[model samples]
Target: MSKPPATILASVKQTASVIFLHGLGDVGASWLEAFNTYRIPKAVPHVKFIFPNAPIQRVTLNMGMPMPTWFDIHGLDQNAKEDQPGIEKSSKYLSDLIEEEIKGGISPERIMVGGFSMGGAVAIHAALTSPHTLGGVLALSTWLPLSTTFPKALISGDKKVNLPILQCHGDQDSMVQVQWARLTEQGIKAMGFKQYTFKEYRNMEHSSCNEEMEDVSKFIVQNLPKVD
Candidate 1:
């Protein structure tokens, strides 16, 4: 499959790039509003933002109804069986996006991958399996899918990812329970993933908040490559 068309916010010089994936049911264009709503363009003017749309697919948890999802969610249980094939496919697509950015002149270390909810799950998977160490990864309001196999996958990779990771979740997230996010943190840490930060927002739910956006902006600024 070809790379999905993206909604891009180009920087003046395009020194760095962020490939952000939207959650299920969302189109890439919707994140343009998010960028403006959060004033991300103003905060990080040197970095480009790329939001890619997921291919429409049937989700089992959604009663097999079709939706734009990176992978199918069979069940919401913590240990529910994951859609490994779907995740791998999406991860490869994400890697292709990263490679494209690299080809466009951004260094692999200057590119970050991130997403929300289901998108975040794929972002984590891509980052873990990528041969090149990236700027970082942002997993927001997301849990670790295929948790049992992720550690082995990381170990089998050609290089270990030492980049910083910023994981944020809502304390009141009913869709992806905060407990599951904590478990994901524990799982990654057990695999010796250093430089991971887990931030919890009070009174928030299964969505992004102003405070979270502010923190994300800070993370972007911190991790972006410094122009010499």
Candidate 2:
């Protein structure tokens, strides 16, 4: 399938790129607003931001209602039914986007992949299976999907180490409980992923705030390739 169209925010002198996926029922344009609200472009100059739209499909959790989602949501439980095929497909799509960045002169090490909610789930899946070492992964307001299979799916050893991962979730997030995020951290650690940080915010729900965005900015600045 052809990749979904994106809302591109090109930098004056692009050296690195960030491919961010939107949550269920959201378009790339929506994230563009969030990025603008946070002034992300100014915070991280010379970095292209690509917000890709998820393909529209029937979401099982919503009673087979059609929506733009990274993958199907079979249930809410951590180990509930997962749409493995959809996850794999979206991961391949993400890889293709990364490859396109490489073709445009950005190294895989200079590219970061991230998302919100369901989108974050896809980002985690993609990063875990990626053949190339990414600069980092920003997963916000989300939980790891297919948790039971993650241990066996990880790349293992040094390849998985030193890859920065910023996971921020709300303590009051009813959509994806904070405990789920904790479990995700434990699973990744068990797989020998050392460079991971899980940040929790009080009273925050299934959404992000200015504080979270600030941390996100810091993560981008810290992970992106340093200039001489």
Residues 33-98, model 1: lDDT tens digits: 787788887777778888888998999999999988898888877767789999999999999999
User: Candidate 2, residues 92-194: lDDT per residue as tens digits?
Assistant: 8988989999999998889999999988988988888888889899999987777887667776446878789999999999988899999888887777777
What are the lDDT figures for the candidates, one per model?
A: 0.86, 0.85
Question: What is the overall TM-score of model 2 with all chains considered together?
Answer: 0.94
| Worst 10-residue lDDT window, candidate 2 | 1-10
lDDT of 1 at 124: 91
In candidate 1, list every pair of residues with a backbone clash.
none
Off by over 4 Å in 1: 1-4, 155-161
